[model samples]
Target: MCPLFSPPLFMQRYQFVVDFVQAHGSKKVLDLGCAECSLLKQLQYHGKGVELLVGVDKDSSSMKTRMHSFAPLSSDYLQPREGPLEIELYQGNVTQPDPITRGFDLITCIELIEHMQLEDVERFSEVLFGFMAPSAVIVSTPNADYNPLLPGLVGFRHPDHKFEWSRQEFQLWAVRLSELFGYSVSITGVGALDDAHTDVGFCSQIAVFNRKPSQNDPTNQHRSRGEPTVYRLLYSVAYPSLSDNNVLQRMLVNEVLSQAEQVKAAWLSGEWAAKMAGAREPYRQGGDICVSLLDVWACPQVKHLCGTLRRFTEALVGERRVPLTPDRQAVIVPTEEEDEEELDEEEEDEEEMAAVEARCTTTTTSVATEDWEEEITHSAVGELTACHVLAHD
Candidate 1:
């Protein structure tokens, strides 16, 4: 028997929700019936502008076991969150009214309503649309219309599912609830079949409900009514971010210095190669090369620079060790060995002066001085190791 879908039905469902949340720029989001917290994990990484995320489920043990997955990783510290993010998981019944979950920008109930009893489904509708009324809501359930296509499949998709609704049945229920609660509803689906089986609709049906304002609605009274907390907090995490001034500066300085060193090392290698080939020095100064800002950004090691390009460039320039041209497009990198070379040249000049003062210099002084300068040049070039150039046009 073949698997139901190529990319898998669960992944498609999560992608659909992620796209919607990101496009809408929803700040506060709640996921109802968030089993194993799979959807929550995806949103934390992919959902833009989502500051607060909450998950509600009845399974406490599973949530606790999976909580460790949300911890900060090494990459997370390297590239901290753009803004503050908090994720909280609660163990509670969806049918019950909770004041804490009110005024959310978005709420998702993926494949959840089908598992509750018929009575509980009604209670959940009232709780979600009336008391916990959010700006928008998303619900998904198994499509009974597509069941016949599955080989040897009988009844609902899962044993826990109380009822699987056909396309017409799900639409009718959604439309009725929307009218009663002062909301607009739209129906869509995921996990589609081939053109031949298009009439059967999708394996999973989705309904998106958006609340509408009313002059005098009974549900409006529940807005101010404070209800006691019923859901037990299972797990909570406040993500680390670069919002801290100290953290931002510290990380920025480290990366700038690291890139500067790499650029300087590359400059030294090229100068040494040119010298060995009997060509004039490739670099203008003592192994110092000029690199464009674009060249610095192109390096794979600098790809993790956390903030905007302009902001990061400003921080890079502020490092003091990295000196940029007046145009700010390129930086002049001086080789580490250049300082030693300058000291050597000064010492040589001082010795030559001392010999002349002694009046013991012969007619061969000019040739001998030339030979000594060549020896010093060779010593500096031989010490350099080969490195790849980070500079580009």
Candidate 2:
């Protein structure tokens, strides 16, 4: 890794795969589920010395667009001095072998397995290990056990994921597959690993399988002459910086502040007043107002606002100055037992409130009167303070 140019953690994983391929002196390489061919681009940019680079994916549209966009950016670095790099794009399924020229030096299926059904994984493994007969195969998937470490994240990382495997589940599958095929498998991890005992720590798990010498020999009975259907050519260009965390962070902050200002204007424009006037007795107990405010906080227009939401909640909590309920005007400290129960309930409520606000913040373009604008600012402060008081009780 370059000290001056730090790629994001996910990109680092792709780099790791490339490094492993280069270290083993692999020349012919193939990537399965190569969406946007980002990894291939990175490999070329990093000068991995791959003579032939092939990428296959089910998404024909994206591949076509990427190929067109990146053609101008493709440089001499992607081509070897001895000969031009043979870059190929194919649309194919992993479960079934296609007419792709076999006997690759290295094959990679990074973050592609979890999209498959367990049965499909079995078929894919057979096709890869038996037919492809690469010297080395690298596969990566999410470690479900590490999900707890991500704040406010729930279920799978992506909705398209069929299922995520824990470390034990992944290892068990790898061992079984290695036994079925004539290969030796090693396991390693990617992404941050903090607190090893309690968490799997690494966000993604990887398996590297090296074929037995006899298995790689051309005389082996496992070798197959299947060819993959020629896939449509997409962009074969230099890797572009797809994303920057710092730039995204700045954009999110600016967007959140802008939305907040819009919210302030909406509040001053009597939007809340109109809703409050129509509310039933139960809804008038600040529940509707809390929901309304949270709707503003959770708008999807702002990107990566989980940390921002936490900060906003903390600020509101710190500025709390009034009681939550109108009837309970006086502050009354509770006994230890009561305090414990109240604390638990408060924590649950706070989490719920945060989730609601984080997912539902609405935007409005209505103008505000000067007097109402001042009142709305003060009212927002008071409401947030009251919500904080409710959460602390």
Candidate 3:
């Protein structure tokens, strides 16, 4: 079997993994539940300046790998990374509230929730919010509906995973948590799943979350009203640079996506929908995770492997940040020849029209603020209205 099937020391919800590194400026990422610290290593280049990759896990043996055991929760550099990284490995349960978690722009939790009891997740998410800045987290888990037992391919199954949730079940929790905590949630996929058949332990999401909202939001009345299929794809495809200018790029990308059918009906063909449909809409669970395919595709490396699909992902990312003009139209070219033609077309169009494209931040970005309002008005509003009466459990 190819090594690609080999899971990381810890399961990584890939979509979130990218966004967290990209959004948090890559400098101060807290890799909670990090297994081998390999994932943290992958993120090393993305860090901008004060970049620090902190990997936390309870396994003492993980300490031996290429990282330093995080110094006990202290302001000083806990195990500094051997390279430019300031990676820290700590013997602690990220699920529990710790002062060390704060100041981070992004957080990652991939397939770790299944190992914890439901009651533990309830408290864990609570603690999770405490450690993060108001924006940006990426998480993923199995879609229970597909597996009925656990999502994702089998064989990695562990006795510890408590109750694997269906896509719906996970989202129920995610939506509630977003409402309660004031974060925006989006989702992506770690690996593709079979919709016609079922696979046990099949991965469901590459969920992303941002505690703080982008200043330029995407919530026009029309934003959330679309057929969610394309939007989920759009979100992932444009994520890496979308946070530029504080997700001004992300919002603009969604804005274009909102009107993509106008660009061409073929882009929205039934075959396309069938291939890209989500097991769940906005697939974020407990409302704290967000998704972006650009985040998925923007490996700063993986683009080569995904090939033409990579270009589709890149074009999607560019469309969001590049401002449209009264005269300019986004050309769709599904072929290599068309791509060359489009570049030629862009130059001709560039001189003819005024570029009103949005200004994006250079730092890694969280989700847009409009999604914040959507979470509030749609799901969060009702959930927030619920009185915080203590649960009997």
Identify the candidate with maximal lDDT: 1
Model 2 RMSD in angstroms: 27.9
Question: What is candidate 1's local distance difference test score?
Answer: 0.69
- Candidate closest to the true structure, highest TM-score: 1
lDDT of 3 by residue, 46-99 (tens): 344434555666554554444432221221112212233334445566666554
| Candidate 2 CA-lDDT value | 0.55
Ranking by lDDT: 1, 2, 3
Better of 1 and 3 by lDDT: 1
Query: Model 2: how far is 368 from its true place, Å?
Result: 42
lDDT per prediction?
A: 0.69, 0.55, 0.43
lDDT of 1 by residue, 167-256 (tens): 999999999999988889999988775899999998789999988877755334432223338887766666656665644665565565
What does candidate 2's lDDT look like per residue over 228-286, in tens digits?
A: 45443443322212133322333444454455445444544656332233322112332
Model 1 Cα displacement at 302 (Å)? 11
RMSD of every prediction: 23.6, 27.9, 23.5
- Model 1 spans > 4 angstroms off: 213-228, 256-393
